[model samples]
Target: MEVTYLCPHCIGAINALDNIILSAKTEKNKHGLILLHEEIWNYSVIQTSSINAELGEIVDFFCPVCHASLNTEKGDHYAGYIRMDASGQESKIVISREYGDRRTFKITGEDIESYGESARKYMYPEWFL
Candidate 1:
């Protein structure tokens, strides 16, 4: 089943061709497009040649459609959006904003499903939801 990701603000679909496209800006003020693998936990990423993002570097993620920042209200350490499965089940998807910090969370109601090795850093994932 294919899952579609949407910007939390504009509710615009963000995934295309199995990649979640997001506008990104690094701390160095470099801007570019970031393509993240749509499958949760995959962690495959591709950045435009214009950007030079180092591993473990944190970058700002934004909705490519509305240009609204996707940074979670919880903290800059994560970015969040909405995810809908093929059956139309929707939930909140939060991911580590820092490059190479493999943490992802799927929040549905009071339930929190954590994935990736770095997810262990957050012992209680429900607080963010």
Candidate 2:
């Protein structure tokens, strides 16, 4: 089954090949394109050499199309977008912005599922709805 990632702001397709691509900027002002595995639980990253993201460093993410900042408005150290599954059901996907923090959340209405190294039950994020 395939899943499509979309920019919450622009609703533009953000996934290509087997990766989800986003524009990112490190706290130190280094910018690059970030490629993350389309598989939600995979933490592997492919980014330009300019982005030397250190552990716990916040890397700001933006939609490649509309350039909308993906950061969650609550400043909870996460960035988010929409994920549409093959069946056309949509969910909100949120991931930690801190480099090396493998925290991810998939929120479908009131159901919140988590994945990655730091997976945990999460509160339903009304802002992402």
Candidate 3:
């Protein structure tokens, strides 16, 4: 199954692989000032240089297109939402601390129960077992 990430703000595609998001990290430039550097899969590292080697703390992942915070809640350690589509089946998998650390799988189009099961199996195998 293929996955795609969309910017919640602009609804723009962010990465190519649709798996594993490399968030921006702060680094110091030659002037010793902090700057945000992001590296996307199959894409060149943004603002990476010899002088900017010190990796700083990353608060949250942002939408590369609109620069919107991906996390649904403030101060969430890690959050992710998955949009799945197969054989005319559409579903959304949202996992976030704001939702009480639960995985919400919403399926639409056809076979709601069956599609939800399949999505859960493909997305989180451990949940089934």
Candidate 4:
């Protein structure tokens, strides 16, 4: 059986199951990463190494406010409210969180569902690096 892998630019791991979705952390400072039905959110900064993840898995990072460690369970998708441009656009956007440069990278919906039906489920995001 041949194991398919994700695009190096997008996911880690040299080989991942074809039916298995993958996510690579682009950012470093990710306090929290959540995967909801249609959106992905990152709470704070997370300083660590490259992230290589699979579906139905938990990625442990950190907490922005309390600076405590946190765990985020990945689902098919997830979402949260976000304020845009400080204008209070208050948009409910779909996205994925990738930590880098002490900032969280908000990925577009296309990026979240890039893996198709094999979307990875985030879980127990307390391990950083």
- For candidate 4, the lDDT comes to 0.28
* Per-model TM against the reference: 0.94, 0.91, 0.39, 0.24
Clashing pairs in 1: none
How should the candidates be ordered by TM-score, best one leading? 1, 2, 3, 4
Candidate 2 lDDT (Cα, 0 to 1):
0.88
Off by over 4 Å in 2: 121-129
Error of 1 at 86 (Å): 0.8
| Candidate 2 worst ten-residue window by lDDT | 120-129
**Model 1 C-alpha RMSD to native:** 1.2
Q: Could you tell me which residue pairs clash in candidate 2? A: none
lDDT of 2 by residue, 37-90 (tens): 989989999888888678889999999999999998884789999999999999
Off by over 4 Å in 3: 18-22, 25-59, 74-76, 88-90, 93-129
Tens digits of per-residue lDDT, candidate 1, 55-129, equal 888889999999999998776588989999999988988888898888999888888989899889778655676
Largest TM-score belongs to which candidate?
A: 1
Q: Rate the local accuracy (lDDT) of all candidates.
A: 0.89, 0.88, 0.36, 0.28
On residues 1-129, what C-alpha lDDT tens digit does candidate 4 reach at each position? 332222222223222222222222323322223322221232322222344334333244332223332223343223222213224322222223321211122333323222322224443222211
